[model samples]
Target: MEHKPLDQLRSVADVQPRPLSREERLQRWIDLLETDPKRRLSSLGEIEYKPPAERALLREDDSPLTVAYEDPVLRADGLSSDRLGDAMRYFALSDGQAHYALCSCLSGRTMEAGTCAQRLRNATGNVAWESAVGAWLLAALAVSLPGLVYLLS
Candidate 1:
């Protein structure tokens, strides 16, 4: 007589599996589809995250975030502190075409920073906080010029 596996022949209560309810499954999916994106600035790397969730894309899984063919928000250029020199050059030499851009379209305001910033904003994305360093530079120039003229003349 051949000996069959105990699990196959006998009713062995070892593994227990439970299915999810329709509502629970639906909620799981809704959690996955919703994405929360934020921008971080520093000497570290920048990346978009789907974050941790208990849901998926559908009523089953979370959908992967899509990157546009020309997504400015997802600029892969070097954002490390080492790249600061290049970024400075970009700010000085170019009007604004090397840095990245970050904007919040829903805010009804748009940020016009550097090329890098623009890239962060998807090139077409709008931002609620529009900060420009150029204006400050111009203001500094104006503020100091009068003093220089007084001293020289």
Candidate 2:
């Protein structure tokens, strides 16, 4: 008999998660600016922007969910050459919010309940979430220009 099942299991084991450094993280974000559906959806979601606590903050009411922004698009700029598209993409959800953010950009960030951290009234722009998102999209666009032409054209 063939060891096909064993081979499949071995393939799964061979797949590994790549570790991303801080610099790499920002670069990745900028790079993703051009394309990515999840990103696009998120940028659109920005129109419906709500307070951080009301929107994308982790909960403590036994839900154990980490409310964080999610970019679930291949090209998440919302649209090509659109200024608003270039604004930034975000989606606040819950649990395992393993997203790329920098200390300087995300500095002074706090967790809140009953509302979004963004709308906490005390929440301020110590963190550079918008900047971070901008950086990532720019990078992504630079590297994927040819593809962009093919897409938008």
Instruction: Compose the digit string of candidate 2's lDDT tens values, residues 1-153.
Output: 545665687767774345444334333334443232122121112223445443333222211011121333312322122222121222221211222121112222322222222222122232557778899999998989988899998
Candidate 1 lDDT, 69-123, residue by residue in tens:
1223222322112132332232221212112231122222322222223353333
Most accurate candidate by lDDT: 2
The clash number for model 2 is: 42
Q: Whole-model lDDT for model 1 versus the true structure?
A: 0.30
In candidate 1, stretches whose alpha carbon ends up further than 4 angstroms from where it belongs are 1-64, 67-119, 122-131
Minimum summed lDDT over a 10-residue window in model 2 is located at: 60-69
